[model samples]
Target: MNKLQIKYIRQMLGLSQQELGHLIGVHNSLISKIETGTANLQPKTEQAIITLFSEKGISDNDATVINALLEKRKAV
Candidate 1:
């Protein structure tokens, strides 16, 4: 995922970088780096996030859906 997507998802989940890192077994700074575009999101971490969300019944699709709705509003 891109930096924007990561940040957006974190905010949508009401999680701080440290909290997400702790849950996913990474250092918080790594999450900061990923969110700032200083580092790429490693595949394992992405999978971990996906797994965590699945276990929590959180769908990433919600972000896309919200963005689409917002775009439609902008068009009016």
Candidate 2:
């Protein structure tokens, strides 16, 4: 997912960066770095985020968009 989508999903889930970080097994600052384009998410972390969004019932279309953005980011 793109940085904006990560932040958006976190907010939608009513989670602080700290909370999300805990769930994903990262420090809160890593979340901030990820959201700000200063860090890259490992594949496992990406899957965790996808699972989180899936559990929240994010639409298939939205998930597609997020995955597309992730692929694009990797290309960069």
Candidate 3:
């Protein structure tokens, strides 16, 4: 996935960099690097996040799905 997708997913899940890193078994600085477009996620880590998001009922649509989920979370 792209950096924007990663950023959007993390935000949609309302996770801080440290929280997201913990979820994906990475470092907080790595999450910051990815969000800032200075680094990339390995395929395995990407798969882990995709699994997590899917588990949370976030569909594999477009960025629109991410935005919708974020809004849905805020409503709750």
Give candidate 3's error at residue 62 in angstroms. 5.0
Model 3 misplaced regions, further than 4 Å: 62-76
What is the number of residue pairs that collide in model 2? 0
> Relative to the true structure, how large is the alpha-carbon lDDT of every model?
0.79, 0.84, 0.78
Q: List the candidates' TM-scores in order.
A: 0.74, 0.75, 0.73
**True-structure lDDT of candidate 2:** 0.84
Compare the candidates by TM-score and give the number of the best one. 2
Error of 3 at 46 (Å): 0.8
Q: Across residues 7-66, which tens digit of lDDT does each residue of candidate 3 receive?
A: 887787788889878887889998899879888777888788787777766668855666
What does candidate 2's lDDT look like per residue over 1-76, in tens digits? 6677888778878999999999878899999999999999778888888787788788668866766876788799
RMSD of each: 3.3, 4.7, 5.8
Assess candidate 2 and give its TM-score to the true structure: 0.75
Candidate 1 has its poorest 10 consecutive residues by lDDT at 62-71
